[model samples]
Target: MLEKEYDVIIIGAGVAGCVAALKLVANGKRVLLVEKLKKIGSHNSRKLDVTESQGIADITAELNLPFNGKFNRSIWYSPNANFELDSRVYDYYVLRGSDVDSFESIVSNRIKSFGGTVLTNAEITNYNFENEYVKSVVINYNNRHQVVNCKYLFFADGHHSKSLEIFGIKERPGPTFIGYGEICVNSELKAGVTHVFFDSKLAPGGYFYLGKADNGEVLSSIVINKALQGNISIKTYYQNFIAANANILKLLGKYKVKNSFVGMGKTGIISRRSLRNMALLGDAGRTMDPIFGYGVRQAIISGYMAAVSAIDCLNNKKRDLDEYEDKLNKSVFQGRETENQKFRNFIDHLNNEELDYAFKSIETIGLSTSLDDFFDNPFNNIGMLLNVTLKKPKLLTTVIIKFFLA
Candidate 1:
């Protein structure tokens, strides 16, 4: 058990929570980071995230951690065709685990160094809300209950967070996908290379992803539409994805499943970002790229932005932190949910043939889009988008025309 009260209490210890706590504690505030897991890196949620920024490098350099998240090549494959993006600049990725070089490990291990406390195996079962402002939380750990009060609260509770359900907050839902997959031994996929497969049959509205870590472990997963076109089993889709990608399988080494999991991938964005005393961070607010699933960068940015907003609010005697929402709106995902939702819907209706055609067309044209530039709201790359869509004008639904041209 840590202190009874603090200046700030964070509900999660993932990337966002750790970053927020680091900043707050660095500013000389008493901070507590609570994680429901038994240890910092023991949860499935604290895994790999293909980020848009150099969050890994920045944090690692600041902390003097040896981890480097540099990647060289990225491959995008349709069912029938594929395209490649060769970047000598930087295509970032962050691995989260107990490894010394992992980003989560690097940040999480330094919580106490910054004068912050991390309580693992803790569940915040209840929260006391007064006049729509959060006052405190009921923590369950070691079969005992304790109440802790704090001046400000952060909900970095992740994608499957029940905080919204408990608070009865309605989330603006997007395409929900059933992400079913496994971690396997890597013998083929070169380090610093990633593959994204677009197949309506395998992933439906979403896509299948396979990337190898520097430690020779490969993560192969597919996000398929929950309401699939055919009444096929998700298991079949997973197996088919593996079968189709023979290169992903261990050719020389014996194939083995390191771990397996099935979970829901929420593409929804919560419109209401904060209350007077509580702020939502990370996937709880769906601060991510809906199409490409780039979350870690957004999560880190939101955490830092929220910490800045918290400092301003606390200095003003805990006044309403309406500026938190404004900050979130203008930064991170940058209030682009409407545009992302439209793009998601547009891609959802696209069949396998259409996707293959789009890939071929991109191969014909070229990807002049930079990772960082496109990360700052993908709508700015409308010229490339229009070039592909104009090839098959019917693929451009009326909704797209009205949204863009209008």
Candidate 2:
């Protein structure tokens, strides 16, 4: 059994776990960071580089943390027209496809420098609950069993967290399949532009992307909203996507597949991100965006928020940990859950004809609207919608009905 009782015990060493440990230790609390994987951020490896939304910059500035991630502008291609987004826009930043390891390593080193203990190859097998709070955890480290007790626990074990079953926390449904791979092509692709296709035939109820990596490789991905586990494979989807997209074929006359990976994303808004003495962080608590599986920023924000909540409870004797969930939902989702759900709902019920018409309208009339303007008023755009309505009234009517239904 471990002799030292930490003030807080954080499971998992991803962005969220590391951030939590860093914050807790900085606030004079003894923290132990534990991970089941041999190394942190190993699950993040893929042919595609990492891309974060504008939230990462906001988080670093707000928390005063030292974070410098390289960013390049990217383009989002709708069905009909391509929307160019400036680098300064608060939408997203495309990280070089090759910086995944270095970025994670930097954060891990930062946590260690703060005097926090990190245990790799550690597994939390069970939990002992005292009354309504987690009292201690049984961990297996280096082929030895040990009991680690703590006043507060932060579970960042990711989407397949074992802590949820131990705590009896139910998970809600979300996105299921995301396939990533790298391909080398002998053609000149757009430097920073990320081509996104919403064709259902390519990626049913989801999207596909083709972007350039720093190493002069093309990183292509097919992200879908269904489960691809049993018999379906990512290669099958990639083949279908290539067959469906002419632009991809024209852009890259011949390509070689280098690597491939499959990932799952489920959108579950846990009503409780925390219990009495413990809280779930990152994908462990289902903090991913419902519309898109963009979660690195969410994971970071949740980790920081969980740390803040733990510190507050530790400093104030009268404070309760219930505020963690409330603060987390507000800070992370920010009332975007409902809006995102509406978008998902529309997509769920949209027929292929309606979707094709919508994309066509965007290609025809969407050229007038900028990316920022469209996001600001995606549905209620009078000028753009009116022009599309004049061309095809049925398309606009179906959109309105779907909006209300969603």
Candidate 3:
């Protein structure tokens, strides 16, 4: 069904967009959520994100929705199992995909149940603005363009948002990220844990992770830079990488892939979060934090914040939504960008041989550490540096020297 007007129009229905809509409608506002995809959730990336923050757990608990699992352990697996660090991780995991029990579906269904209208396979072809406020938006649906009136627009449509160029808005450019993932049934992986592999041959431009294998299903995903990977295709490389790993083979036993998905996006935050009454959240803004391997929690937090701010503005005659960016800066996004920079630098400075040595040093110390330190602060940890220096002096002489030189 189509409506003549809505109090707010939300673009995209991922975790961020859906949360925004849920909050708006729950606050007694009319919201129209439009998605170009035929459905709300990711195709088949179940247990796709293992977050390292408790911030997002609030939203699930608030909605009375249970998360998939709580991860208390993570292993930073080095090349060839030469060295690995099994450490403590304080975070929860969420299930993705179009399944009824998935986070995306649950949040989306809640919106509709609360009187929000969701139109899948819909695209915003054109829009009109009155002064600085949005007047109406044109959505292309069912092979026809339809117009609907709305006072505000919120776009959580990823880094390359559809609404950006239309308003002459400049976006913060970032790396082009491509990912491939799949889920298989009857796998032999233990739940409540995760593994991150950082080998160049295994995942050239990026890396791969295997975890959250539970209830007869396990998720496996790999990321790579095609140009960096050279002649081999990502699929071929991924297939071979998975099969060649003895640990993965042992875990697989006998299994069949049920569903596969391809994920593509641009990294970094949006340069302009709000233009007039339009605002961007999620990947459109800067919800993707690299250190944790995923940022669904951050995405959900950003969406909820955007929703609350918009509600206050729409209900109380406020019009300074540009301050949304400022709010984000003080909240979830605070200081993390710098950490992300350090993490990237650390990754860039390491290869297979150096990585093995670093993990070997960590293993020697018997430090039950959360990877957050390495990804969030790199080698800046004083105690860790001291221990590594005394335990693996050669690692400090070689890898540390190279890290500084780069």
Model 1: worst 10 consecutive residues (lDDT sum) = 59-68
TM-score of 2: 0.85
Candidate 2 backbone collisions, by pair? 49-97, 80-363, 81-363, 174-267
Taking all chains together, each candidate's TM-score versus the true structure is: 0.82, 0.85, 0.87
Q: Name the runs in model 1 displaced over 4 angstroms.
A: 45-47, 54-68, 87-89, 97-102, 129-132, 165-168, 229-233, 247-256, 367-406
Question: lDDT tens string, model 2, 1-406?
Answer: 3545888899888768877887787788888888887876666654444446555676666444433233346655444445445544433322222244344555667677877788778888877777877778888998888888888988898788876776677765655546655555554676555566676555666777766655566767777767523456666877777786687777665677665655666677555778788888988888887776653678878898888888888888633578778887777787777677667767766666676676666555546766456667767687766766667776678777888988
What's the alpha carbon RMSD for model 2?
Answer: 3.6
lDDT of 1 by residue, 5-112 (tens): 888999888778878888787788889899998878665543455555444356545544323355768888897888887654565556666555666667876778
How well does candidate 2 score on lDDT at residue 298? 83
> How many pairs in model 2 have backbone atoms within 3 A of each other, for residues 3 or more apart or on separate chains, i.e. clashes?
4
Best-fitting candidate, measured by TM-score?
Answer: 3
lDDT of each: 0.72, 0.69, 0.72
Clashes of each: 0, 4, 0
